[model samples]
Target: MDLSIRVIRSDEWEKARELRLAALRDPVAHLAFLDTYEAAVVRPDSFWQERTEGGSEDGPGTVRQFVAEAPDGRWLGTASVLVERAGAESFFADVPEGEQTHVVGVFVREEARGSGAIDALFEAAVEWSWSLAEPRVERVRLFVHAENARAQAVYRRLGFAPTGVRVALHGSEDAHEVEYEVLRPAA
Candidate 1:
């Protein structure tokens, strides 16, 4: 349960890439993610390089990716949060002009599941989201597949409540992703 949680570094792009590919190959990948291993693998190295660097601590202030590194240095899980701009719009919902972090791309190795890695990753992500300055983060949100009960339970336990806003799934408008959020208390 003593996992090392921290932001990934740009130099560790290869490791990050490997873990992501592994995640995409999981049985639930279709329901859990928008992209597939085949598509990700076909992308040029420069894409991975830029993606890794963008999620690194040295990257822009709006995006962050965290990884759970086992004691032996292997990555056991990963989570990413993207800060949304209300004026610019977001991939799934409206940002409302205040700072908000959209959590996504969550994954944990099968062997690492049920060991608090998911909780640890969420803690890191929520902590980082609230730590931002400037506009200041007002809330953290994420979308979960309607059928992903496991993920929904975890999010509820972490204090994210359903926002009553749902988005249609990519290429499948009839199916929807449920939106949830944890609002930061007003001062």
Candidate 2:
């Protein structure tokens, strides 16, 4: 099965919404996403439109969403990255004093697991981060739920290493998200 990996376009908002809803319903959604399916489902269409537009290729480079689409046009998986600059207050984890990209909204269909789609999605996301011009990204990072060993293994296999940083989730110290990162490759 051939899968094309590419950044999403603004007009594809509905498709993006569909994929996100499906992802939120996945069995591991609780551990993989901070947002709940119930919450996401009730959001207005405008919310999805704006979200997709901001993460689209035609939008500002601050965010980009990549999708793996099969020949039949179904999205096999999706991933998004957000640029966090130095001295800025990030909504999630704190960053070092440098610009970096944060990966989020990662999801792959259960049937698509083990199909290299995840690797391809990450490759596109990381490449997009390194391609930014102004305040060039210094590294690519992501937060995985502390109990999510399945995701940890995949991230490690993809060359991401734990940054020895962890952040509380939903103001609960008992639940945390561990940070992992990969520095920009030397030119």
Candidate 3:
């Protein structure tokens, strides 16, 4: 149950790839993520290297990935934040009213569920978002499949509230993903 949260390192591409593949294989991945294990597994090593570098602490500040590492060196969970500026084309929904951070690629190993690793990962991700220098994030948001009650409940417990904006899930016209957000704490 002992774990520490930290931003990934550029050299830890292999570990990042392994954890991401495992996440893609999780039961809820279909509802929680846009990429599939099959698709990700075929990506070249260079792709993973670049991805790791882009999300690493030394990488550009537009995105960051945080991992919860167990005492034994195993990654228990991860969450990433993408800075979204107003007027920029969003990958998921309409343009935002102001700078915000979108939480994505959330995952925790089954054995680590309810072990506090997920919470730790989220705290790091949200904290990093709020600490951005240039475009201070006004809020941290995430999209959860409408039917993913479990994830929705967990997010709500973590202080994210529905923002009244719903976007149809990509590739599924009928299904939707509800947007939830936690505004930055008052200064």
Taking the tens digit of each residue's C-alpha lDDT, what string does model 1 give over 1-187?
A: 6689999999988998999999999998887898999999988888888999999999987789999999899999999999886576777766776778899999999999999999999999998988888658899999988888888998999889998999997688577899999998777
Per-residue CA lDDT of model 2 for 1-187, tens digit only, reads 5899999999998999999999999988999998989999999999999999999989887999999999999999999999998877776765679899999999999889999999999999998888888879999999999999999999999999998898888868699999999999898
lDDT scores of the candidates, listed in order: 0.89, 0.92, 0.91
TM-score of 3: 0.97
What's the ranking of the predictions by TM-score, best on top?
Answer: 2, 3, 1
Clashing residue pairs in all predictions, respectively, total: 0, 0, 0
How do these models rank on lDDT, best leading?
A: 2, 3, 1
Tell how far residue 89 is off in model 1, in angstroms: 1.3
Candidate 1 residue pairs in clash (backbone atoms < 3 Å)? none
Candidate 3 regions with alpha-carbon error over 4 angstroms: none
Segments of candidate 2 deviating more than 4 angstroms: none
lDDT of model 1 at position 111: 91
Write down the TM-score of every candidate: 0.96, 0.97, 0.97
